[model samples]
Target: MMRLELNLLIEGLHDFEKAKRLGSLSNEYCRESATIYLSQEDSSILGVSDGDIVEVSSKHGSVKVRARVRSDVRRGLAFMPPSPYSMALLGLDEHPSIIKVTVSKSSGEPTSLTTLFTS
Candidate 1:
């Protein structure tokens, strides 16, 4: 599948309040996390729509999660709230903030955060 290089931004969202209060293991916390924000143009190019499952792969690893279409993010850019899903691709290391990843529509369901942290 075709891939693109995007300026990745892992930032806090409004749900930070709820996640902080509920704790990371809480369902509410997991529900409010790991959403990948992509521009409408980029989403279409990948043959995906909002809420579609997509696999984002870096040289390190890959994570399958839900895609979110947003005007807030410009083309060639993506935003994902910090969570276990992104952590799988990030691992535990001092890596560059900007990553070249392949984002493509996934044939399977969006991976759960539990599985992400596990195997």
Candidate 2:
């Protein structure tokens, strides 16, 4: 698998997530929150298709999330809402609006917020 450094932009909660009250542990909430949007170019480079699981890592930590190829995203960049998956990667030590992350295809399941705190 190929791993590439991509800039990850942490975004606000999606409408669905907001409706779910941000901390819901439902499967729908988990599926939405644990998704990473990538540019077509980036997806192609990583050989990832929509809904494919990918491992995103930083110096702080790593999290697995489903990938979504989006035309709105720019190459070398990724977008994900503020959720447990993204938070796991960012860690608790430092907070940056945007940061570089190593991304690659993964066979693991999407990470949940509970797992992050428990582990």
Predictions in order: lDDT: 0.75, 0.85
What is the Cα-based TM-score of model 1? Answer: 0.82
The residue pairs in collision within model 2 are none
Each model's TM-score, in the order given?
0.82, 0.87
- Write down the RMSD of candidate 2 (Cα, Å): 2.0
Candidate 1 residue pairs in backbone clash: none
lDDT of 2 at 52: 97
Off by over 4 Å in 2: 13-19, 91-93
Task: State the lDDT of candidate 1 residue by residue for 1-119, as single tens digits.
Answer: 75666766676767655685789878777756756889988988888888888888877788887788988779999977767766666745536355667788886766786687678
CA lDDT, candidate 1, residue 113: 69
lDDT of 2 by residue, 1-119 (tens): 79999999988656545736845777677778888999999999999999999999999889999999999889989988887777777755666668889999999788767788897
Which candidate should be chosen as best, given TM-score against the real structure? 2
